[model samples]
Target: MRIAMIAAMAKNRVIGRDNKMPWHLPEDLRHFKAMTLSKPIVMGRKTFESIGRPLPGRHNIVISRNSQLSIEGVTCVTTFDEAMTMAGDCDELVVIGGGQLYQQLLPKADVLYLTLIDLDVDGDTVFPEWDDGSWQLQNSVTATNDKGLQYSFNTLFKKC
Candidate 1:
Protein backbone atom coordinates (compact mmCIF):
# COMPACT_ATOMS: atom_id res chain seq x y z
CA MET A 1 0.00 0.00 0.00
CA ARG A 2 1.15 3.54 -0.73
CA ILE A 3 0.76 5.83 2.26
CA ALA A 4 -0.09 9.43 1.42
CA MET A 5 -1.25 12.62 3.10
CA ILE A 6 -4.13 14.76 1.84
CA ALA A 7 -4.51 18.03 3.72
CA ALA A 8 -5.15 21.72 3.28
CA MET A 9 -2.75 23.98 5.10
CA ALA A 10 -2.18 27.69 5.33
CA LYS A 11 1.06 29.60 4.78
CA ASN A 12 1.81 29.00 8.47
CA ARG A 13 0.83 25.35 8.30
CA VAL A 14 -2.40 25.94 10.18
CA ILE A 15 -4.89 23.12 9.73
CA GLY A 16 -7.79 23.72 12.11
CA ARG A 17 -9.18 25.69 15.01
CA ASP A 18 -11.38 24.26 17.78
CA ASN A 19 -12.13 21.12 15.78
CA LYS A 20 -13.22 23.08 12.71
CA MET A 21 -11.45 24.14 9.55
CA PRO A 22 -10.11 27.65 9.75
CA TRP A 23 -10.93 28.44 6.18
CA HIS A 24 -13.85 27.85 3.87
CA LEU A 25 -12.90 26.77 0.39
CA PRO A 26 -15.54 24.73 -1.43
CA GLU A 27 -13.31 23.87 -4.35
CA ASP A 28 -10.67 22.41 -2.12
CA LEU A 29 -13.30 20.41 -0.27
CA ARG A 30 -14.58 19.02 -3.56
CA HIS A 31 -11.06 18.18 -4.65
CA PHE A 32 -10.48 16.41 -1.37
CA LYS A 33 -13.66 14.38 -1.74
CA ALA A 34 -12.77 13.49 -5.32
CA MET A 35 -9.35 12.22 -4.42
CA THR A 36 -10.43 10.24 -1.36
CA LEU A 37 -13.51 8.59 -2.79
CA SER A 38 -13.50 4.80 -2.79
CA LYS A 39 -10.17 4.74 -0.95
CA PRO A 40 -9.28 3.79 2.61
CA ILE A 41 -8.75 6.93 4.68
CA VAL A 42 -6.98 6.95 8.05
CA MET A 43 -7.63 9.80 10.42
CA GLY A 44 -7.34 10.76 14.05
CA ARG A 45 -10.36 10.47 16.32
CA LYS A 46 -10.64 14.21 16.57
CA THR A 47 -10.78 14.60 12.84
CA PHE A 48 -13.41 11.93 12.60
CA GLU A 49 -15.53 13.62 15.22
CA SER A 50 -15.13 16.99 13.56
CA ILE A 51 -16.81 15.70 10.45
CA GLY A 52 -19.52 14.14 12.66
CA ARG A 53 -19.79 10.91 10.68
CA PRO A 54 -17.96 8.49 8.46
CA LEU A 55 -17.41 9.67 4.93
CA PRO A 56 -19.31 7.51 2.49
CA GLY A 57 -17.80 5.34 -0.26
CA ARG A 58 -14.57 4.83 1.74
CA HIS A 59 -13.31 2.84 4.64
CA ASN A 60 -12.92 4.98 7.73
CA ILE A 61 -10.02 3.97 9.94
CA VAL A 62 -9.63 6.11 13.01
CA ILE A 63 -6.76 6.23 15.50
CA SER A 64 -7.42 6.71 19.13
CA ARG A 65 -6.27 5.32 22.47
CA ASN A 66 -9.75 5.10 23.83
CA SER A 67 -10.61 1.48 23.32
CA GLN A 68 -14.13 1.93 24.61
CA LEU A 69 -15.14 4.62 22.20
CA SER A 70 -17.12 3.34 19.29
CA ILE A 71 -18.10 5.06 16.08
CA GLU A 72 -20.58 3.59 13.71
CA GLY A 73 -19.13 2.61 10.33
CA VAL A 74 -15.55 3.19 11.45
CA THR A 75 -12.85 0.76 12.39
CA CYS A 76 -10.95 2.21 15.32
CA VAL A 77 -7.33 1.50 16.05
CA THR A 78 -4.99 2.74 18.72
CA THR A 79 -1.80 3.41 16.82
CA PHE A 80 -0.45 4.29 13.44
CA ASP A 81 0.98 0.81 12.99
CA GLU A 82 -2.38 -0.74 13.72
CA ALA A 83 -4.04 1.53 11.21
CA MET A 84 -1.49 0.47 8.60
CA THR A 85 -2.20 -3.19 9.22
CA MET A 86 -5.94 -2.63 9.01
CA ALA A 87 -5.54 -0.96 5.64
CA GLY A 88 -3.90 -4.01 4.10
CA ASP A 89 -4.29 -4.48 0.34
CA CYS A 90 -5.47 -0.94 -0.14
CA ASP A 91 -3.63 0.57 -3.08
CA GLU A 92 -3.65 3.98 -1.49
CA LEU A 93 -3.77 4.83 2.23
CA VAL A 94 -4.83 8.44 2.57
CA VAL A 95 -4.01 10.18 5.86
CA ILE A 96 -6.84 12.55 6.69
CA GLY A 97 -6.04 14.39 9.88
CA GLY A 98 -6.34 17.07 12.54
CA GLY A 99 -2.68 17.67 13.47
CA GLN A 100 -0.97 15.13 15.72
CA LEU A 101 -2.10 12.26 13.51
CA TYR A 102 -0.43 13.87 10.52
CA GLN A 103 2.75 14.28 12.55
CA GLN A 104 2.78 10.61 13.50
CA LEU A 105 2.37 9.26 9.97
CA LEU A 106 3.90 11.86 7.68
CA PRO A 107 7.29 10.18 7.73
CA LYS A 108 5.81 6.90 6.55
CA ALA A 109 4.02 8.49 3.63
CA ASP A 110 5.44 8.14 0.12
CA VAL A 111 3.58 11.06 -1.36
CA LEU A 112 1.85 14.21 -0.18
CA TYR A 113 -1.14 15.81 -1.85
CA LEU A 114 -1.20 19.22 -0.21
CA THR A 115 -3.68 22.00 -0.85
CA LEU A 116 -1.81 25.18 -0.03
CA ILE A 117 -4.31 27.83 0.84
CA ASP A 118 -3.14 31.43 0.53
CA LEU A 119 -4.52 32.90 3.72
CA ASP A 120 -3.23 32.61 7.26
CA VAL A 121 -5.57 32.85 10.18
CA ASP A 122 -5.62 32.02 13.88
CA GLY A 123 -5.59 28.28 14.32
CA ASP A 124 -4.99 25.86 17.15
CA THR A 125 -4.16 22.74 15.23
CA VAL A 126 -1.09 22.90 13.03
CA PHE A 127 0.58 20.49 10.68
CA PRO A 128 3.89 19.15 11.87
CA GLU A 129 7.09 20.52 10.39
CA TRP A 130 8.46 18.18 7.76
CA ASP A 131 12.04 17.73 6.69
CA ASP A 132 11.98 19.28 3.24
CA GLY A 133 15.47 17.92 2.69
CA SER A 134 14.11 14.42 2.19
CA TRP A 135 11.37 15.36 -0.24
CA GLN A 136 11.02 16.98 -3.65
CA LEU A 137 8.16 18.77 -5.31
CA GLN A 138 6.55 16.66 -8.01
CA ASN A 139 3.95 19.03 -9.38
CA SER A 140 1.70 21.99 -8.60
CA VAL A 141 -1.29 23.91 -9.93
CA THR A 142 -2.62 27.22 -8.68
CA ALA A 143 -6.31 28.09 -8.79
CA THR A 144 -8.86 30.48 -7.38
CA ASN A 145 -12.36 29.47 -6.43
CA ASP A 146 -15.65 31.29 -6.92
CA LYS A 147 -15.30 32.62 -3.39
CA GLY A 148 -11.98 34.19 -4.41
CA LEU A 149 -9.93 31.88 -2.27
CA GLN A 150 -6.55 31.34 -3.89
CA TYR A 151 -5.04 27.90 -3.46
CA SER A 152 -2.47 25.57 -4.95
CA PHE A 153 -2.55 21.83 -5.33
CA ASN A 154 0.96 20.57 -4.72
CA THR A 155 2.26 17.06 -4.94
CA LEU A 156 5.48 16.04 -3.23
CA PHE A 157 7.40 12.80 -3.25
CA LYS A 158 10.05 11.41 -0.98
CA LYS A 159 13.53 11.54 -2.53
CA CYS A 160 14.46 7.99 -3.30
Candidate 2:
Protein backbone atom coordinates (compact mmCIF):
# COMPACT_ATOMS: atom_id res chain seq x y z
CA MET A 1 0.00 0.00 0.00
CA ARG A 2 1.14 3.52 -0.74
CA ILE A 3 1.19 5.78 2.30
CA ALA A 4 0.43 9.47 1.87
CA MET A 5 -0.07 12.42 4.20
CA ILE A 6 -2.76 15.06 3.61
CA ALA A 7 -2.43 18.19 5.68
CA ALA A 8 -2.61 21.97 5.63
CA MET A 9 0.14 23.64 7.58
CA ALA A 10 0.82 27.27 8.28
CA LYS A 11 3.93 29.10 7.10
CA ASN A 12 5.55 28.08 10.39
CA ARG A 13 4.29 24.48 10.04
CA VAL A 14 1.60 24.82 12.66
CA ILE A 15 -1.01 22.13 12.19
CA GLY A 16 -3.29 22.63 15.14
CA ARG A 17 -3.48 24.61 18.31
CA ASP A 18 -5.96 22.88 20.69
CA ASN A 19 -7.20 19.66 19.14
CA LYS A 20 -8.71 21.56 16.17
CA MET A 21 -7.70 22.77 12.77
CA PRO A 22 -6.57 26.39 12.76
CA TRP A 23 -8.29 27.37 9.53
CA HIS A 24 -11.51 26.78 7.60
CA LEU A 25 -11.22 26.69 3.85
CA PRO A 26 -14.09 25.17 1.94
CA GLU A 27 -12.12 24.48 -1.21
CA ASP A 28 -9.44 22.71 0.78
CA LEU A 29 -12.11 20.64 2.48
CA ARG A 30 -13.55 19.78 -0.91
CA HIS A 31 -10.10 18.73 -2.08
CA PHE A 32 -9.66 16.61 1.02
CA LYS A 33 -12.98 14.87 0.46
CA ALA A 34 -12.22 14.28 -3.17
CA MET A 35 -8.83 12.75 -2.42
CA THR A 36 -9.74 10.66 0.60
CA LEU A 37 -13.24 9.51 -0.23
CA SER A 38 -13.58 5.71 -0.22
CA LYS A 39 -9.96 5.29 0.93
CA PRO A 40 -8.56 4.03 4.22
CA ILE A 41 -7.38 6.94 6.33
CA VAL A 42 -5.03 6.43 9.28
CA MET A 43 -4.86 8.99 12.03
CA GLY A 44 -4.02 9.34 15.72
CA ARG A 45 -6.56 9.21 18.53
CA LYS A 46 -6.48 12.95 19.08
CA THR A 47 -7.15 13.69 15.43
CA PHE A 48 -10.12 11.38 15.48
CA GLU A 49 -11.42 12.99 18.62
CA SER A 50 -10.99 16.40 17.14
CA ILE A 51 -13.10 15.36 14.16
CA GLY A 52 -15.88 14.27 16.57
CA ARG A 53 -17.34 11.66 14.23
CA PRO A 54 -16.42 9.24 11.55
CA LEU A 55 -16.39 10.88 8.17
CA PRO A 56 -18.90 9.37 5.82
CA GLY A 57 -17.87 7.27 2.80
CA ARG A 58 -14.48 6.13 4.07
CA HIS A 59 -12.80 3.72 6.43
CA ASN A 60 -11.59 5.65 9.43
CA ILE A 61 -8.79 3.96 11.31
CA VAL A 62 -7.66 5.49 14.55
CA ILE A 63 -4.24 4.44 15.91
CA SER A 64 -3.84 4.30 19.63
CA ARG A 65 -2.28 2.13 22.33
CA ASN A 66 -5.54 1.86 24.24
CA SER A 67 -7.42 -1.18 23.05
CA GLN A 68 -10.33 -0.78 25.39
CA LEU A 69 -11.57 2.53 24.13
CA SER A 70 -13.76 2.42 21.07
CA ILE A 71 -15.74 4.81 18.89
CA GLU A 72 -18.77 3.83 16.91
CA GLY A 73 -18.51 3.92 13.12
CA VAL A 74 -14.73 3.81 13.32
CA THR A 75 -12.20 1.05 13.73
CA CYS A 76 -9.83 1.45 16.66
CA VAL A 77 -6.46 -0.18 16.26
CA THR A 78 -3.82 -0.39 18.93
CA THR A 79 -0.71 -0.39 16.80
CA PHE A 80 0.53 0.64 13.41
CA ASP A 81 1.06 -3.00 12.54
CA GLU A 82 -2.53 -3.82 13.35
CA ALA A 83 -3.74 -0.81 11.42
CA MET A 84 -1.80 -1.93 8.39
CA THR A 85 -3.11 -5.43 8.76
CA MET A 86 -6.67 -4.19 8.97
CA ALA A 87 -6.22 -2.05 5.90
CA GLY A 88 -5.36 -5.20 3.96
CA ASP A 89 -4.74 -4.62 0.26
CA CYS A 90 -5.71 -0.99 0.14
CA ASP A 91 -4.11 0.78 -2.82
CA GLU A 92 -3.35 3.78 -0.66
CA LEU A 93 -3.30 4.81 2.99
CA VAL A 94 -3.73 8.45 3.87
CA VAL A 95 -2.07 9.50 7.13
CA ILE A 96 -4.25 12.34 8.26
CA GLY A 97 -2.55 13.58 11.39
CA GLY A 98 -2.07 15.18 14.78
CA GLY A 99 1.68 15.82 15.01
CA GLN A 100 2.96 12.54 16.51
CA LEU A 101 1.22 10.49 13.84
CA TYR A 102 2.88 12.55 11.13
CA GLN A 103 6.32 12.09 12.68
CA GLN A 104 5.83 8.36 13.03
CA LEU A 105 4.51 7.75 9.50
CA LEU A 106 6.27 10.35 7.36
CA PRO A 107 9.39 8.25 6.99
CA LYS A 108 7.40 5.38 5.51
CA ALA A 109 5.21 7.50 3.28
CA ASP A 110 5.74 7.55 -0.48
CA VAL A 111 3.70 10.64 -1.31
CA LEU A 112 2.78 13.78 0.55
CA TYR A 113 -0.17 16.08 -0.24
CA LEU A 114 0.39 19.24 1.70
CA THR A 115 -1.82 22.35 1.58
CA LEU A 116 0.50 25.18 2.35
CA ILE A 117 -1.37 27.98 4.05
CA ASP A 118 0.16 31.43 4.24
CA LEU A 119 -0.46 32.19 7.91
CA ASP A 120 1.68 31.63 10.99
CA VAL A 121 0.06 30.91 14.29
CA ASP A 122 1.18 29.67 17.71
CA GLY A 123 0.59 25.99 18.11
CA ASP A 124 1.82 22.94 19.97
CA THR A 125 1.09 20.55 17.12
CA VAL A 126 3.42 21.10 14.22
CA PHE A 127 4.25 19.19 11.06
CA PRO A 128 7.55 17.33 10.98
CA GLU A 129 10.32 19.08 9.12
CA TRP A 130 10.88 17.65 5.67
CA ASP A 131 14.40 16.46 4.97
CA ASP A 132 15.78 17.91 1.76
CA GLY A 133 17.93 14.84 1.24
CA SER A 134 15.07 12.35 1.41
CA TRP A 135 12.12 13.93 -0.37
CA GLN A 136 11.76 15.97 -3.55
CA LEU A 137 8.93 18.18 -4.67
CA GLN A 138 6.84 16.82 -7.50
CA ASN A 139 4.00 19.28 -8.05
CA SER A 140 2.65 22.47 -6.57
CA VAL A 141 -0.62 24.17 -7.52
CA THR A 142 -1.70 27.37 -5.89
CA ALA A 143 -5.40 28.16 -5.56
CA THR A 144 -7.80 30.19 -3.50
CA ASN A 145 -10.29 28.39 -1.34
CA ASP A 146 -13.98 29.19 -1.22
CA LYS A 147 -13.29 31.55 1.65
CA GLY A 148 -10.75 33.30 -0.55
CA LEU A 149 -7.86 31.91 1.50
CA GLN A 150 -4.76 31.39 -0.58
CA TYR A 151 -3.17 27.95 -0.36
CA SER A 152 -0.86 25.74 -2.32
CA PHE A 153 -1.46 22.08 -2.96
CA ASN A 154 1.94 20.44 -3.10
CA THR A 155 2.95 16.86 -3.68
CA LEU A 156 6.32 15.35 -2.78
CA PHE A 157 7.80 12.03 -3.71
CA LYS A 158 10.37 10.32 -1.54
CA LYS A 159 13.87 10.00 -2.97
CA CYS A 160 14.84 6.43 -3.53
Candidate 3:
Protein backbone atom coordinates (compact mmCIF):
# COMPACT_ATOMS: atom_id res chain seq x y z
CA MET A 1 0.00 0.00 0.00
CA ARG A 2 1.11 3.57 -0.67
CA ILE A 3 1.34 5.57 2.56
CA ALA A 4 0.31 9.20 2.66
CA MET A 5 0.03 11.85 5.37
CA ILE A 6 -2.50 14.64 5.80
CA ALA A 7 -2.09 17.52 8.23
CA ALA A 8 -2.85 21.18 8.78
CA MET A 9 -0.21 23.28 10.46
CA ALA A 10 0.84 26.86 10.93
CA LYS A 11 3.94 28.32 9.26
CA ASN A 12 5.74 27.45 12.50
CA ARG A 13 4.52 23.85 12.25
CA VAL A 14 2.04 24.07 15.10
CA ILE A 15 -0.65 21.50 14.38
CA GLY A 16 -2.59 21.66 17.61
CA ARG A 17 -3.08 23.36 20.96
CA ASP A 18 -4.60 21.84 24.09
CA ASN A 19 -5.44 18.68 22.18
CA LYS A 20 -7.20 20.45 19.31
CA MET A 21 -6.31 22.38 16.21
CA PRO A 22 -5.17 25.91 16.99
CA TRP A 23 -7.16 27.53 14.25
CA HIS A 24 -10.59 27.02 12.73
CA LEU A 25 -10.34 26.55 8.98
CA PRO A 26 -13.54 25.06 7.60
CA GLU A 27 -12.26 24.94 4.05
CA ASP A 28 -9.27 22.90 5.08
CA LEU A 29 -11.56 20.62 7.08
CA ARG A 30 -13.67 20.03 4.00
CA HIS A 31 -10.59 19.43 1.93
CA PHE A 32 -9.42 16.82 4.42
CA LYS A 33 -12.78 15.08 4.42
CA ALA A 34 -12.98 15.02 0.63
CA MET A 35 -9.48 13.70 0.17
CA THR A 36 -9.82 11.05 2.88
CA LEU A 37 -13.32 9.87 2.08
CA SER A 38 -13.56 6.09 1.68
CA LYS A 39 -9.87 5.69 2.57
CA PRO A 40 -8.41 3.83 5.50
CA ILE A 41 -7.13 6.47 7.91
CA VAL A 42 -4.62 5.73 10.65
CA MET A 43 -4.09 7.95 13.62
CA GLY A 44 -2.73 7.88 17.17
CA ARG A 45 -4.97 7.69 20.21
CA LYS A 46 -4.76 11.36 21.06
CA THR A 47 -5.66 12.25 17.53
CA PHE A 48 -8.70 10.01 17.67
CA GLU A 49 -9.90 11.47 20.93
CA SER A 50 -9.39 14.96 19.60
CA ILE A 51 -11.70 14.12 16.79
CA GLY A 52 -14.10 12.53 19.34
CA ARG A 53 -15.60 10.04 16.89
CA PRO A 54 -15.02 8.07 13.78
CA LEU A 55 -15.13 10.13 10.63
CA PRO A 56 -17.97 8.95 8.42
CA GLY A 57 -17.31 7.18 5.10
CA ARG A 58 -13.78 6.08 6.12
CA HIS A 59 -12.11 3.27 7.96
CA ASN A 60 -10.70 4.43 11.29
CA ILE A 61 -7.64 2.55 12.47
CA VAL A 62 -6.18 4.08 15.59
CA ILE A 63 -2.68 3.25 16.84
CA SER A 64 -2.23 3.21 20.55
CA ARG A 65 -0.18 1.25 23.05
CA ASN A 66 -3.36 0.59 24.98
CA SER A 67 -4.34 -2.87 23.87
CA GLN A 68 -7.69 -3.09 25.64
CA LEU A 69 -9.05 0.07 24.14
CA SER A 70 -11.97 -0.30 21.82
CA ILE A 71 -14.37 2.09 20.18
CA GLU A 72 -17.54 1.47 18.28
CA GLY A 73 -16.99 1.39 14.54
CA VAL A 74 -13.21 1.74 14.96
CA THR A 75 -10.28 -0.63 14.87
CA CYS A 76 -7.56 -0.06 17.44
CA VAL A 77 -4.04 -1.28 16.89
CA THR A 78 -0.93 -1.40 19.01
CA THR A 79 1.62 -0.48 16.36
CA PHE A 80 2.00 1.23 13.02
CA ASP A 81 2.92 -2.12 11.52
CA GLU A 82 -0.39 -3.51 12.68
CA ALA A 83 -2.25 -0.65 11.11
CA MET A 84 -0.32 -1.12 7.87
CA THR A 85 -1.00 -4.84 7.83
CA MET A 86 -4.71 -4.29 8.23
CA ALA A 87 -4.76 -1.69 5.48
CA GLY A 88 -2.39 -3.50 3.12
CA ASP A 89 -5.10 -4.16 0.57
CA CYS A 90 -5.86 -0.50 0.17
CA ASP A 91 -4.23 1.29 -2.74
CA GLU A 92 -3.50 4.31 -0.58
CA LEU A 93 -3.15 4.43 3.21
CA VAL A 94 -3.66 7.84 4.72
CA VAL A 95 -2.22 8.81 8.10
CA ILE A 96 -4.09 11.59 9.83
CA GLY A 97 -2.17 12.25 12.99
CA GLY A 98 -1.09 13.97 16.17
CA GLY A 99 2.53 15.07 16.65
CA GLN A 100 4.04 11.73 17.68
CA LEU A 101 2.46 9.72 14.89
CA TYR A 102 3.55 12.28 12.29
CA GLN A 103 7.10 12.22 13.62
CA GLN A 104 7.23 8.44 13.59
CA LEU A 105 5.60 7.76 10.22
CA LEU A 106 6.46 10.77 8.07
CA PRO A 107 9.57 9.01 6.79
CA LYS A 108 7.42 6.09 5.64
CA ALA A 109 4.94 8.18 3.72
CA ASP A 110 5.06 8.52 -0.06
CA VAL A 111 2.87 11.59 -0.28
CA LEU A 112 1.95 14.52 1.91
CA TYR A 113 -1.24 16.55 1.73
CA LEU A 114 -0.45 19.61 3.83
CA THR A 115 -2.47 22.64 4.68
CA LEU A 116 -0.06 25.45 5.40
CA ILE A 117 -1.77 28.02 7.50
CA ASP A 118 -0.31 31.48 6.99
CA LEU A 119 -0.14 32.67 10.58
CA ASP A 120 1.97 31.44 13.44
CA VAL A 121 0.23 30.55 16.69
CA ASP A 122 1.26 29.13 20.03
CA GLY A 123 0.55 25.43 20.38
CA ASP A 124 1.50 22.39 22.40
CA THR A 125 1.52 19.96 19.47
CA VAL A 126 3.73 20.27 16.42
CA PHE A 127 4.18 18.50 13.11
CA PRO A 128 7.67 17.19 12.45
CA GLU A 129 10.15 19.10 10.37
CA TRP A 130 10.72 17.49 6.98
CA ASP A 131 13.42 18.18 4.41
CA ASP A 132 12.23 20.25 1.50
CA GLY A 133 14.69 18.46 -0.78
CA SER A 134 12.98 15.16 -0.08
CA TRP A 135 9.55 16.16 -1.35
CA GLN A 136 8.51 17.39 -4.79
CA LEU A 137 5.56 19.73 -4.91
CA GLN A 138 2.73 18.31 -6.99
CA ASN A 139 -0.06 20.82 -6.43
CA SER A 140 -1.01 23.91 -4.44
CA VAL A 141 -4.07 26.10 -4.12
CA THR A 142 -4.45 29.05 -1.79
CA ALA A 143 -7.66 30.33 -0.27
CA THR A 144 -8.85 32.58 2.52
CA ASN A 145 -11.06 31.40 5.36
CA ASP A 146 -14.25 33.07 6.53
CA LYS A 147 -12.30 34.53 9.42
CA GLY A 148 -9.67 36.00 7.08
CA LEU A 149 -7.04 33.33 7.69
CA GLN A 150 -5.14 32.51 4.52
CA TYR A 151 -3.94 29.00 3.87
CA SER A 152 -2.80 26.79 1.04
CA PHE A 153 -3.55 23.16 0.40
CA ASN A 154 -0.37 21.61 -0.94
CA THR A 155 0.28 18.11 -2.18
CA LEU A 156 3.90 16.92 -2.21
CA PHE A 157 5.27 13.61 -3.33
CA LYS A 158 8.24 12.16 -1.51
CA LYS A 159 11.30 11.94 -3.72
CA CYS A 160 11.99 8.39 -4.75
Ranking by TM-score: 3, 1, 2
Deviation (Å) of 131 in candidate 3 = 1.1
TM value for model 3 = 0.97
Residue 136 displacement (Å), model 3 = 0.3
- The digit string of per-residue lDDT tens for model 1 on 63-97 reads 99898778889999998888889888889999999
Higher-lDDT candidate among 1 and 2? Answer: 1
lDDT per residue for candidate 3 within 1-160, as digits (tens), equals 8899999999999999999998888898899999999999999999999999999999899999999999998999999999988876889999999899999999999999999999999999999999999999999999987788889999999998
Residue 98 in candidate 3, Cα distance off native in Å: 0.7
Candidate 2 ranges with C-alpha deviation above 4 Å: 146-148
* TM-score between candidate 1 and the true structure: 0.96
Best by TM-score: 3
For model 1, give the RMSD to the true fold: 1.0
Where in model 1 is the C-alpha error above 4 Å? none
lDDT of 2 by residue, 74-135 (tens): 88998878888888888998989979999988888999999999888888899999887898
